[model samples]
Every structure is written in structure tokens, then in C-alpha cells.
Target: MGGERVGRGRGTPLRAVAYAAGGVVLLAGCASMPDSGDLRGVESTPRQDTQVRVFAMPPSEDASSAQIVQGFLEALTSDDPDYKTARQYLTPEAAKTWRPELSTTVLSDVPDAQPDRPDQDDTGSLTYTLTGTKVATVDAQQAYAPASGAYNKLVHLTKRTKSGEWRIDEVPQGVVMGKSDFQRNYMSVDKYYFASNTPGAGEGFLPTAVADPVYVRSHVDPTTRMVRSLIGGPTNWLKPAVRSSFPPGTALREDTGALTPDDRGRLTVPLNDEAAEVGTARCEEMAAQLLLTLRTLSPAVEEAELRTGDRQLCTLSQKGADDVAGRGALHRPGYLYFVDDEHRLVRIAAGGSDSQPDPVPGALGEGEKALRSVAVARDERTAAGVSLDGGSLYVGSLAPGGALGEPVLRSRGKTEEDRLTAPSWDAQGGLWVADRDPGEPGLYLLAEGAEEPLRVRTPDLDGRVRAVRVAADGVRIALVVEKGDRRSLLVGRIDRSPADGGTDEGQAVTVVGLRSATPELEQVTAMSWAGDSRLVVVGREQGGVEQMRYVAVDGSTPDVPPPAALTGVKAVTASEDERAPLVAYSVDGIVRLPSGAQWQKVTEGTAPVYPG
Candidate 1:
């Protein structure tokens, strides 16, 4: 197995992971690229959730300069529309000039309760310091990026002569808020985009939806803002990688009108004259994008229509939308493979009854050698096996009578803890695995038919990469790196650079976009890609017990809990299905779940995996 030792009943199993205090801190900045298509008839409006409340009011006027600065910081957490109350803390001119939408620095710690007095009073204008240990930031462009260290912020206030009140004159373009209040006032919403390589990708692999995290009003019409944000291009960080399908210069036809869903959950959106130029195929693509993006909103969208100045563009069905983005590509594994007590490969049909697990006709499958865990390719045409001792990785066809190839990827670790992680496969049939050799840690990638594995680099990941899972989109990676006795769950964007002279691009990852995806979880031990943007992880809090939950790449947790608890769990895995069945290797043995449906034991096993 990938761990130091396989778990046995009541034995000292492998160590677990921990998480950040409180729930995961999902910072603001979620929005989809605006672009929707023609409905056969008129495009529908969006649904507005009326229950969300407006933001809290700012400190009363005539407050002290420092108090006004403090009140402005607090108002940043409110869900007010247009941030009018937050603006009240600013001088009217500054209010007109200040752009809070520039970016939001989400502090992992609390802001200073009292601002540091100004270094020098500049006549009527005074400056105060508000700094904290920064966690992450969402910019005006809606780009989310992680930032470390203490943020040095200064809010400059001016004494207003008219009301004898002090108001902020100049401050950072973005807003700043403490983590706890951020949770209370903010919510996470996904903006839909097609994968860069999918059929809907007019160019390369494009994300159909961009999940945007924002401080949505708790009781007002969040739908309008979500749609507006969608029409806006993806946040700046993801812009280089993904493109929006919305027409050039596209915009809502109405400036002040809100888009609301009808009783049947159908939305009609009115676009300006610019969107009137798309063809039928383009219109369908756009509508599909809207269907997926709007589905995350309250009252949800079942179907939708598009309109240009009341002139019907076209309509799209839910199924059509799903098909366009290939969202229905989820397929359960044909057979669940595991290693048995005798060090042989075994399997259980995904839909079979409680029958004794069976072995196959290959070398490893027929008990040729002791194996630790297994990885099946997405095509299910081939598989990879790790040596029971964790020193080697072998690849072979999954068919009966298939001969397991020589070790395709080998490890050079001095101890069991430094062996290779469970191998993962990307969409392009590339094998990705990492060596946990603490003294010489490295990541390797092997494409089909390659003679040897090529080493890939992790720029800022200084610790041991315990686990690695590539997303179905083939652009992002979910990794667990253990460092300084702590583990973190992070998301890295893959950069495929052109190799020397015109060869395929060399695959490398940058530390810049590698954001801390699971801040709530401190020591993440095991992780698997649950969907394109979410991961089902097993982790614990610092000095706390282990727990399993589904968290987004943006540090947002699922609305519901994960499957039942399995103490002494050594490894857990799931298929690409967002709600797919989970297979775990507990101290008891190999178990599969649908929850409460008895964990049908297959055989004695340590590691298990499904096609990504």
C-alpha cells in the first residue's frame, strides 16, 4: 500500500491528517464566463432567491476616524447590494472612487481589533493600520489566489467638515475580512464552463463553468448577480486557461431589470443586440452553458431560453445541455479490483451480488507476485500495479491472459514510507505518480508507449507528495503534501510547455496558482477526485479526530456529510461519479458502500482505485 504499513485490527496503523480550525474558509470569487445560446423561442429569465438578506449597516455618522476605518472593514463582510453601507464609512468622493470589487483578501486570522495610529497626521487626513496573516484573495476580476504572510493594509480617513464625521479617504482597492465573519456572510456558488478539450470547447480544453465564491445576500435575489457575474468573463486568474462563449460585447438587455425563473424552473434571459448574431450551433452551446451555471442558483434552472430584444433566439433542454458539455461521461468501473490475502489480484463486479471475489488470468492477477494496490485506466483497457513492498509500479492490460509488463515506474526510496504513491491516469492516457523519497522527492509522468517515465517538477511543493489525483479535465491536479509533520490539500494548474525545438510541451506545475484548496482540513492523508472540481478527502484537525468530507478546490465543503465512518481505514477511493460508490480498505478488509447497504467485503486488500 502507499502508507507506511497496512492496517490490521487494533494495530498501530498509518498516521492520519488534520485541518484548519472551523469549517473550510472558501474565499469569495466565483463567476462563469458570460455566454448563452438561442432557444427555439424567447430566452427565459433567471430565478431570484428572495430569502437572502441585505448587508448590515455601517457605524453611525460622526464616529471617530479609527472607528470609521474599523466599521468599513466590518461592512466588507455584509451582503449589501452595491455596498452602499460600506460606502457610508467613506467620504462621498472616496465612495465614488473606491472600488471594493477590485479584490478581497480573506485573512486566515482575525484583523487587528484596534488600528495602529497614523505615523503622522496629515492635517485633515489620518491613516490607520489594519493587517492580519493573509490566507487568500479574490480579485475584482474574480480570480482566487492564495497568499501567505501578514498583509499590511492602511485605511486613510479624512475629517468631513459638513457633518463633523470622519470618513475613509483612501484605502486599498479590495476589501478585507476576518475568517469567521466570512463564513457567516459568504456562500460558494459554481459558475459552469465546458472542459477545455470537450466538444463544447470551441478551442482547447475549456471549463464550461467557473465556480465563483462570493458574499451573496442571504435573503435577496442572488440569481440576478450570479447571472450578471456569469456574463462577465471568468475571474482573472483562470482567464488565461479558459474562455467564455458569451458573444463579443455581450450584456443583459435590461440595465435595472432582474432575471427570475418561472414556477417551472425555466429561465429566460434577455441579451443586448450584440448577442443577436450567433448561429444555431453557437446558440445551443451558449444555452447549455447557462443551464449548467444557473443550475447552481436557488429555484435552479431546468431549461432556459435566450432572447435579443424580445426576439426569440432559441431554447435548450437539460439533457441537451448535459450532452453538449459531456457532463454525462461518468461511468462506473466494470469490475472493482483489489489485492487478496495471498497477494493476488481479485475483483467484484460493480453490480454483482455477494459472491466470492474471483481472480483473473494474468501474471499479477494469477498470484505471480505480491502486490500492494492497483490503478485502472479510464478506458479500463489497461491497469497498473504497485509491488506489495512499494518499490515498483507495473502496467498491463486488464483483459484475461494479459501479461503484466516489467516495472514501468520504479521507486528509489530507502524505506517503505518513501515509496511511490498510488498511480493516477489523466484523460490523455498519461500515468502520473510521485516518489515520496523524503531525501529526493520527485514526480514522474509516463505516457502510453513511452520507454521511460519523465520527471515532472512541483515548483513550491517542498514536502513529500503523499497522494496525487489528476482531474478528469486533465488541467488541474489534487495533491496531498506532507511537510513539517503537517499535510495540506492543494490544487495545481498543469502547464504543458513546448518541449525543446517543437516537441510536445513539457508538463510542469507552477506554485503561483497552487492554492490551498482544503484550508479547513489540516492534515489531509488520502484524497481522490470526486468530480472535475471537488475532492473526497480523509483528514483530521490538528490534535483532533479524523473525518471524511467532500471539499471543492476552492476550499468549500459539500452541503451534506460524506459516507459512513470507517475507523482503521488505510485507503479509500471512488470513481469519477460525483455520488459514485466508495471502496475502502479497512482493517476488516475490502469494503464497498452505498451507505447502510452492508459493506460487502470482497477480499483482503490494502490499496484500491477506480478509473479517473
Candidate 2:
């Protein structure tokens, strides 16, 4: 994941912390701070300002059943705070029962309204089959997961006795909005959660916060809603993997109003009586969580204070939050490195610079053995690489006078991607390699000091694992898998056994819940984790050129401008900092952005990387 420090990240990632008690302040050390040089900036084309249409009155009284169906679908797309206008399309009785916040079904296109019986024009029943792909679904609990196939919905309408209006009788709760409309009406937000601080990678128990991406009402006080959702708890899938400092059943004091920050960027969350039962330390934990979650907003709240009615609790400032950020738990490598023409590992400084590529000290620099792809350990003292023939994997020390070691893991496949993929190092110092062996493809894990690699069985990943990068968390893996001609980016949870009773490498660290993080990218050639929870992807659509953009692991792509272009790129890499400029190995050479200034060439290299 080889460099020592990163420049400032893309956005100020959610470095804020959460607490349980009153502001005693936490001590979770995140990452090693790197001296950010002049941070490179991209002068992206300005975003087009567009005004969204809010909900209007319901369909007219004389509207047809199909008209009402189509109008209701369009109304769902509108940024209506309450479903009042949409309720107009529904029967008075049904309006009171329907709940649109249950789940958000995001379709690639608008819903296609079709009569169950096309021949019956006066029939009371109509179906709105979602068009394009389902893309992803955001449940009522604010959990986002990638979903495929169709979202065919049946809606029944009954004529209103008083107004003679064609009103929807029964339909599912939650809105079904088109992707375009979803983009306009909803916002992609991240609520923060604490990483499980189990000791690993010889670093002991270091804590860090992870971002859980979800969609919310963009115009609605989104910042406050994020806090509300945080108190509600993490999604079902991530609950086991993450920790929340807030006490269970903790909620905002106000049941209906949106929690807002003051002009000083201080947001105070008023909790229920449950907070009173909790201790002061726990109160600080609660405040830390609020600080981290609220800071993800556009106009971020810099500080958070907890309260019960008028009584003030602990206050968590940015400094206290930063103190416990725990980001450093996942070490960022020191420099940008890649395989040179001589098949030796070489290096250059990160960020936008025209630094000459130099051979890294050690066996990798000697190029005694031909190397295809390589990954450096977080310690910067060891490396793993795939042989030029793609038949074997090798790990050696980066220290001076070291030599390439024997094959740690080997492949028996026929294709390049199958035989061996790029080796990756996790924060735990585990070396991960994928054997594409089309005949019996599999992913294997090898921890430091372990002799044999343990086979990792992943769901639906039969022989399709194209690239593997272990995240800093050490418990998750990001794989670029190919299915037919289409490629999708997915993140899988690596659930290790309850205790360390078995072989470290062979221990059953089950890789479960393979969720798509970049379903929109038609083909993903390479990818790297940008921050604690975000990923920088290198791919193109069905016919687009290789480009790079940032995407959240929950299949949520940021609403920023188009990604920077990397012409003829075969692979890409970036500093752990989300804000750092990306480095790519185009057909020409190694390139880094704000290309607006110029994607300065570092050298001729591929597989440039930093310690994961």
C-alpha cells in the first residue's frame, strides 16, 4: 500500500472522533502525520448550477389512472420535504399509512409505468417497473448496498369518493426515484463509525473512524439528519464490524426538528434521559462520534456538544476529536514506488513533482529476478512481487543488501491475471495475492511469519478476482472482479475467527458480504483505498478511456466533477490522503496530477504504490 507520508488528503477526511462520556477527550492516534508540501490543486471545470423542483400539488381530479401513476412517479423525484403533494395522488386513507422513508430504491432510469393488463384501460391496477439497473438501495436505517435486477412495483389506485380523483390506493413505502432525480433530490452522506480496535500488525490496539456512506435529503438539514442517523446506529451489515460510542437507544432530544449548528460551527445534540444514566467518559465518546459524523457535511460543524434539555454535557472540539482520530492505525507508506523497465522496484516522491525515479534500496532494486507487479509492506522494509512469467509470488526485504526471496505463493493458471495478481500489503503486514487459475481460481492470504498461504473463499468470486488490495483496516479487501465483458468494483468484509487458535495465515478469515463499491464504472482495471473508507478507482465505461475518480465503498460516487484523465493507463495508485493527487502509469510514463498545472512525469514505471 511503500511511501512514508502523504500530502494533505483530497477532502479533510472524517478525522473527527466519537465519545461515550462527557468531553474527557479520547486518545485514539490515527495515522502518522506527513508534512504536506504545497498541496497540488486541480482546477476542475466549474459545476453547472441547477435548481431542483420541489414537490407541487397532486395530480388533477380528472387525471387517468396511468396519468396519476406517472405523475406520482415524477412527484417522487421532486424534492418535496413531506410527501404531501405525492399524498394528493394517494387515497386519504392510504396517505396516512404510506411511509416513504422505509427505503430508497435508486434505479438507473425512471420507472416504466405499464398496465398489468395492457388491454384494460379502466383497470384500477398499474405497475411501475424500474428501468435500467437497480444500482443500489438505501434502507430506512441509512444502509446502502448494491442491488441488481429489476425493481418492478405494483401500485393500485382507487377513485376518491368525494373528489372523484384517481388516487393511489396501496403502494410500497419509501420512494422509487430515478438515478438522475436521485442525484438531484438526494445527497450522498457519510456517518462515521469507530473501527474495531483489536490489536494487530504489531501496532497494538489503534483506533480509527470509518465512513459509512448513505443517501439523504440534500436540501433538508442534511448535517443534522446525518447526526440523527448516527444515533440510530450503523447499518445491519456493518454493525458487527464497527463500533459506536453513543449509548444504545440514544436519540436527539427533539423528535421532529432538524439539529443545526451555530454560526461558530458548534453543533449541540440534545439527548434523552438515557444520556443521564451514562457516565462522563461515555458522554465524551458520544460527543466524538457526533463530531466525526457532523464534520462530513459541506459546511461542517467544527465542534460538537452534548446536552439533555437545557443542561450542558461534554463538548468535543476539533482538537479533541483529532486527538482520537485513530487514522494512523492504517499506516501510509513513505513514497510512491513502481516497477521500472528493468523489472526492479523504483521510487519517486509523492504529490506533483518531476522527481527522477530512483531504485529503492534492497533486493527489489537489484532486478536480479524479473518482476511483473509488486507491493511494498507498510514497514518499508519488505516487498512482494509477481514474477514476470506470472507463475510465482516473491517477498523480499527492502533493506540494503537484501535479495529476492523464494516464492511465497505460486499459481498454476494459464492467463496473466490468473497466474498472479499484484501483491498487496495490509496494515497488519499480511501479504495478499490472487491466483486467477481459470481452472480453479482463488484468493490466498499470507500473514507475516506464516509459511503457507490460507485459501480465502469469497462468495460469487469464482475465478473473477482481477485485482486485490488489502485495506488499511486489515479486515476488508477491495477486489476488481470481472463478470463477462462487464467489470465491477467490490469490497468484501474479512471476518476472522473468534480467537487466534489456528494458524495465523491459515486462520479462517471469512471474506463475506461482497458489496459493489463502484457499480457505475463499466470496467475497473485498478483501484486503491484513498482514505479510511473511500476508494480511488481507475476504470472506464463500456467505451470510455481509463480515468480515475473517488467512490465510497457503499456504491456512492461523490457528486464532484468528472475524474482526471489518465491516457492509456493500465494501472493507478494514490497516496492514502484522499486529497493527494493521483499517480498513474500511462503508456508514456508515471504521471501525477493537477494536470491543470501539468501531470508531471515521475519516471517510466507501473504499479506505483504507498504502504496500504
Candidate 3:
């Protein structure tokens, strides 16, 4: 997070005291100067038909003592290059008081210095002057001056020369002065990539557009950039830019504890009975699962394969050893869990850190176990009696230190028709899968001892089910579909009676307006019970904005409103008790909350929630 000051800025002079006094008079009602209406002239005055008025001139008519003083101060403090011509407007003592060093300092730093040339309508020389000496005050050095009041001069300035060209000449004493106190400091660009600010998927940059007014495109990679937060927009700069800085809040750092994996190269933990048990441990578990899964599935995880893109655009191979920055009092963690042969979740792993580090951190505890257990396997034949969860194991074959394993996909069928597009399980032991073949959309239900899987056909829904879940009654099924611009939450009933063929399809209901704004919600990646009656749908919005939303099982419109003005929502899932669900966005950190809890995270990570 490095930042440099903009070279171009408006000028403010030190001797504008007389102008300040005029402003004070206007404030007190003693004098009425320009209001918004008068300021409008400032714009129009530059566009008049007459010979272009290069600079403004003082009024021709006699002005009050205050006005005269304002004219004097403005002339001396003017940024215009012809300012030296104002010498004639000052009194003898005032001319001597006009310092050259001040003028040089003010004009030297300007990006481009071209003063306005005098115009035909310029006012003539000075017509008034004032002088005073020995006035006690504070000087520019911030030190107090003695009781003696030093002599000062005020010059009445105008744009014109002689012969009605227009001008007022003569400096007056009793000058008032004002100056600005803006300063600059060092801002490192590295900070923007590592600090934690807002969570979820959002797009902003280090030094951002304003601070680093140079870059044309500033996109960051969610996998590695590790940006924590954003700050200093037009409205807010005085506040801390990222969540990790200074007086940290609980909302950001609550679940940031460390966890290590157990023996058997597995992160085993008991599943809680309550439906809404979303604890820090659960979150850590989920995060580990996703990262480990990604590591095993993607060929690019190797030290030499981590490039900017797929198929070799700009190779970003990983280099060097692995280590974790010190675990902090406030660090949010990510993990994942799976079932072992004994029907217990035995493995856990740490999710990739969201906050960028010069040298990234290593996985803690079950982190290695999760990674080592990840493997990709393929079975040649298919059968209807197969359970998708059968081959999936919670523990790895080797110890926790072993390398990751690839994913394994299992299905039951004679041919490719037996392929499953959408697969989900209900608490009632029913598994549902969907397909989008040309003949008809296929929906299959597999239960214990059912030789021929219950099959349902819905040609209307060729490729709808990215996510499927069994309803509470075990008699109903829910299918989440993604179509053109709209993604719907669809519900149907499980029918045992064979229909046109040997399959049974659930009735369909439309959940519209789910993807009203882009990016659209194209895929339903995860969905869980928000409560006994409510459901939360976590999916990818069109253009890759991850989001979480809710709907009711009673066929009512979803009440779970999207996060207010939130941008990145990577993944969403429900807790055991169906209370709040955690959402992982593209932002550097993960945010946890119920349907109503706002985004909260301490440090940043890709996946921060898991169910065990």
C-alpha cells in the first residue's frame, strides 16, 4: 500500500490576511460580498465576448475600508505571473514589505506555471494605501513575536493601466494573514495488498485511483493478491483504511485462533446435533477443505505452475519454503471436513491466507492433513447401487505430512446416461442427481436397496440443477437452476409412481428476480437450512460476484436480503442449527454472520467456514 502525493494542487498564499478579514466581515453581516450567485460570475466572467479578461480587476467605485483591505491582500497573494506589476498599487512601505522569497516558493512547485496576461479592461494603478508597524503576533515559524508590532503594507490591486484601462494602486497597513496546514507522509503500496478492510467480493486498489492516479486497469487476483481492505474514497480518508490497523474491532478478529491436525493424517471432529452450530472451529474446517481440494484438483498449485492464468500466459510459479506469519490475537482461519471410513470427520486443514504477505504463511494443524487427503481417482464402471459418498474418506491414506490427493468421482449406471450433473443428499438418506441430455432432463433418486434408481424426466429443465437438496419431508426435492439472465430456486415433489418412463420428477415453482442485477447469480454452489422453515442459497452472481440469499420452504419469496451494497460474496453455507450462515467473498478475508449478521472477519482468507 504505497502512495505518493499528486504534484498538482491549488495554491494558497501566506499574506491573505486582509482577505480573511473581509471574509470575517461577510460572516458577521457587516459586509455582503459574493454568494453562490456571485460565484457563478467567476465562471461566466472567463467566457465574456469582450477582449478576454486575463485576470480580475478591483471595482472602479470607491469601496469601504474593508473592501480596500481585501483588494490589497488579493493583489499581493495572487498566483498570477504578472503579480510583480502590482508594485505600483502598494504604498512605499508596503512595496518594501512585498517579499520575493514568498512569491518564488509559491510559484515554484506548480505543475505548469503560465500566469494570465493583462486584458484591455484592466483597472489602473493604486488609488488607496495603508501601513502599520510594530504589531505583536505569531510568525510563519510557529514562534510568538514580541510585543512590538512590525510595520506592514496593504496594496490596492487592479488589472488596468492608465487612460481608463482600469487600475487601483496603493498598499494599506493593518494586513491580516492566513495559511493552510496540509502535509504529506510516506504510504507504501505493499500495505494495500496485506491489510484487512472490508470483507466479501469488492474491487478496489492500493493507493486506489485517487492516491495512485497512474494505473489504467487495477484488477487483483483473489487467489494470491491478498488485499485486506480499502480506504480513502472521496468521503472517508480520516478513518483507518484497513481492518488490521490500530484499535481493531471484534467483528474482524473474533474467530482467529490456531488449530493443528491430529494423527492418522486426518482433521477429525465430532458433528454437533444442533442444526445451527456455526462455531469458529466449523468455519476453520470448511476453509481448509476448499483450499486443499483446490490444491489437489488444480495442476497449477505446484511451485512452478502458479501463473497469472491458465495455459501459460504469465507464469507465476511458487518459489521458496512455506511458513506462517505469527498467529495473532485476531486472525480468522479457514478449514474443511469430510467423513472417514468409520463415519467420522477425521481431517482438517487451513485455508489459504487472504491477506497478502511478502512470504506467505504455512498451514496450521489439520492443514497438512486436509491437503494430503485430497486425491483424484476414477472408476471405469458405473452401477445404480453406488453411493456418491461411499468412496469419499475423511482421512488420508498416509500420515498428515503426505502430499495432496486428486478428487474422486463415483456414479452408478450402465452407460454415459448414468452420468450425474447435479448431486445432493438429504438428511433422510435420499440422494438426487440431474442431467441435461437432449432427449430429456434426467432426475434420479437413489435409496438403499433400490435396484433401478427412481428416475424423473423434465425436458423443460435440460440443464437446471447445479445444486439439489432433499426437502424436510423426504417427499419433496429442491432444484436450483441457472438460466440466461435469471437464476431461480425451484422446488418439486418426489413421486414414487412411474411416470412416462421409469423416473419421477418433482413439481416445479419459479423463484424469480434472484439475479436482477449483475453480475447475475448463475450457479447455486451451496445451500443449507437457515432454520427449520428457511433456506439459504449461496451462489455465484453473474460476472463472478459471489452472494448468499434466502427463501422459505413454504413457497414464499426469500426474506434474506443481500448484504447492503456488498460486492464480493465467494461462498455461503448454513450452520448446524440453521442460525446464521458464513459467506466467503473475493475480498482478502472471510465474513461470518447469520441471515442478518453483517460481514465480520479479523484477517483475510479464501474459505473461512466448514461443517463437521
Best by lDDT: 2
- Note the Cα lDDT for every prediction shown: 0.65, 0.68, 0.30
User: Across residues 1-612, which tens digit of lDDT does each residue of candidate 1 receive?
Assistant: 000101111323211111222322211110110111110110111122333332444555435454455456555665566788788777778888888777777776546532344333325666666667787776665555556788887667676777776777877787777665555555566666544532234554323443434444343456776777777766654555555678778888866487787888778988898889888877877887777766656546777888897688888978778666654234556776677778776767765554477775567677776787777777777777788888998887767788876788778899877898888887667778888887778887787624478777677676778888877665677888887888999887665544553565453433236677777577887888776556788888877898877877776555456767777667788776645578788878877777457566666666767675
Tell me how candidate 1 scores on lDDT.
Answer: 0.65
lDDT tens digits, residue span 395-436, model 2: 888789976767878788876656888888876677888888
Which 10 residues in a row give candidate 1 its minimum summed lDDT? 30-39
TM-score winner between candidates 1 and 2? 2
lDDT of 3 by residue, 313-333 (tens): 121111211111111111222
TM-scores of the candidates in the order shown: 0.78, 0.81, 0.28
Which of candidates 2 and 3 reaches a greater lDDT? 2
In terms of lDDT, model 2 sits at: 0.68
lDDT of 1 at 533: 59
Candidate 3's TM-score: 0.28
Residue 241 lDDT in candidate 3? 25
lDDT of 2 at 510: 66
